[model samples]
Target: MISRLLLFGATGDLAGRFLLPALARLSADGRVPDGLQVVGSAHQDWDDRTFRSHVATRLQQHAGDVPIEARDALISRLRYRAVDLEAAGSVAAAVGAFDDGGDAVDRPAVAVYLALPPVLFPAVLGALGGADLPVGSRIAVEKPFGTDLTSAVALNELLTRVTGGVEEAAFRVDHFLGMPKVQALLDRHAPGRPLTPVWNSASIAQVDVLWEETLGLGGRADFYDRTGAVRDVMQNHMLQVLTLVAMEPPARQTEGELHAAKLELLRSVRVCSAAEVPFRTRRARYAAGTLAEPGATGGRAVPGYSDEDGVDPARGTETYAELLLELDTPRWTGTRFVLRTGKALGTARKGVALHFRTAAPACDPGDAERVAADRLWIELDAPLESRQPGVQVTAPGERAAYGQVLTDLLSGGSRLSVSGEEAEQAWRIVDPVLQAWARNAVPLLEYPAGGAGPPPLEQTAGSARG
Candidate 1:
């Protein structure tokens, strides 16, 4: 049982909404051990009192909305420390409060929740190490583990140097990976599933990840510029979604083993061969566009990438990217992993759609080949199946029910939740793709933001290169 929850960024976006309520729920449910202490750490020059006050405000904004009285009780457990990232040994010193009385925690079970930028990870890990957290301490890490493969490898190497090679203790969260349907896909649709037959080359034709955001980079423009949709979407989140949908099951269902097997699958992913990579990259920079928010007008003047400060306006930095990807794994060797992501879209969505090839005519010589096929859409937004008009139909045609995996994973930390190893492997596979973009002036198809990605994607059979 974790008694002390060390929050690295008390005032950050994630800590305010996600962590606060999550911890409040944990506290309310008694998952947190007694004498529970919440340590808020950041470079915010707030002293103990100011930091505690900040915590109270956060509670009001988050946990205090419903339980005002209980908010005080939970707020009482929170302590703010003015810890500097540059100051050595500050982490050890900041976390010392939980150990006010010797052995108060019995065993050091601290969850070091990191809400800082990805770059600060190594330094923070070092500070926490100096804190000398006892065994059973778990560290939570956010996405973009690395902007690319080399960066990811370097980060993992740095982590190993600090922890001296501890495995599975790191909670690398993609948030999307924590969904219940993702777990169900792993458990039910694995290699031996009855549905496996349809997902194979002879039956299934394509799979795609649709992750579109309705809002542009309001203040996060700088961060968004450096790591476009490639690192943000394809390299990490969507690839994790892709692998789960495409990878062959391991001999057994263990996290480490499964991830290692996934690494093998990704390694087989051809790195350089241009044809294998394809010329289907579509990227867009949003101009001032109308947001679909409740009160938006014809064009409410939302800022685009170029409008943001501290960014090169000439750079073709993509706010939207779409790639018709192909995997080397035998299960989905020929099928396309159609990926699409963009900022300033009309709607916010993140999910995968499985488009199955329609079955061939059985015995009727008169039956013509079908153009549009059936699809299984797993979505985060509104859940509905796609349907078309039928002849003489009394009611609308049957539509498939889109499922929500987010709600399931949020309530329970299922294993299908993207593991750190899987995140790293994803970076490993896409490293070549990024390098290809840099080394060669590959043509980039331009699509306006706030629209469907660069026209529709097209792929040719047996055209893949080594």
Candidate 2:
């Protein structure tokens, strides 16, 4: 167990909304040891008392459900320091203040959680490069790992060097995978399961991993304009969902086995070529319109995507992105995986849907059998109202997605964390599409908010710029 946690960016939005709340829940459950210490470092100049007060306010706002005593217990463990991320010495000094025990064998483990922005990863890792992190120490990093494949590779290499070539010490966190539903999906396809046998090309025809939302960018224009939809959703979150749905069942549920299976599946994803890009991908931005309320006729008006606050009209950044990907492995040779995400959609539908091949109906003398294709929907956002049975799973009561992530991180497990190679392979699969869209090789369509997204690929492919 980790005896101490060094939480970077403790005053940031992520820490207040997710990390602190998660830790508070664990504290409530008595999973947090009384002797455990938490060190919070950020640019804020607040002292320990002031930081605890701030934490109290944030916990009330975001984790009101957690008992007051638990919240207080967590706050009691927190100490604050103002550390300069850009300066390696400053970071090293702040972290170095927390001393490990006498020897490596008796030392209590210390874990570092980087809740800061991706741009600060290199600097923080560089600082830790010189800091004396005790043996068995771990580092948990947030996502948007890199802007592209090259950057991801470099970041991985830097992390490896920082940890003295121990890849397991660096945990690349993807909170989406920490959701109980996603974890259940992984367990659902374990060896000997009924679903495992039919989860392949022979039975399943196509898999759709979609993340559609009715909410527009909520004051994140500075980040959204640069990231757009593809990088924001598809490249990491959606691809991870795809791997969980389609990867071959691991020999066992061990972390190494699961990691190997996911990595192999990601490696099998065929990267789109220049020629295939046009027809295989689609991009669009939402136009000005009213967004309908859930299960109601009334709605609120929304501005067009490009007119949103802080967006660059000239960047041609897409608010909606779609990609049709294929795998070269025999298990999925003929199957397709469609990944899509959009903002300000008519409805919020986030989940993986598996479409199974239509089975031939029995011959009847006078009646003709009309059999529709079977679909198993693993609903994430809401329950579906389809004739076919759908599966909806939520995080085990009171445990949010980040809670599960922290559980794995603190326990020194990598099953829920993304590996370095997995991150690079995801970029490789989507890089071609991003490049094609950048060069204007693919046409950008306009779809109204509160309506269906851009037209199908076949309808727009002919109009793609040459």
Q: Residue-wise lDDT of candidate 1 within 21-57, one digit each (tens)?
A: 5566555555445776778888887867786677678
Query: What lDDT would each prediction earn against the true structure?
Result: 0.61, 0.81
For residues 1-466, could you state the per-residue lDDT of candidate 2 as single tens digits? 7778899999998898788998999889887655878999999888999999999998997788899989988998889989999898888777765765575446676789999888889989988888877788889988888989999999999999888888789999888887766777776556665566676789877778989987677678888898889888788889999888888876677999888888999999988889888788989999998876544346667799889989998999998998888888888877878888998888778887777786522322321123344766666544232221221122342247888888788888887799999999999998888888899998888999989888755355543222
Worst 10-residue lDDT window for candidate 2 reads 385-394
Error of 1 at 268 (Å): 4.1
Residue pairs clashing in model 2 are: none
Number of clashes in model 1? 0
Clashes per model (N, Cα, C within 3 A): 0, 0
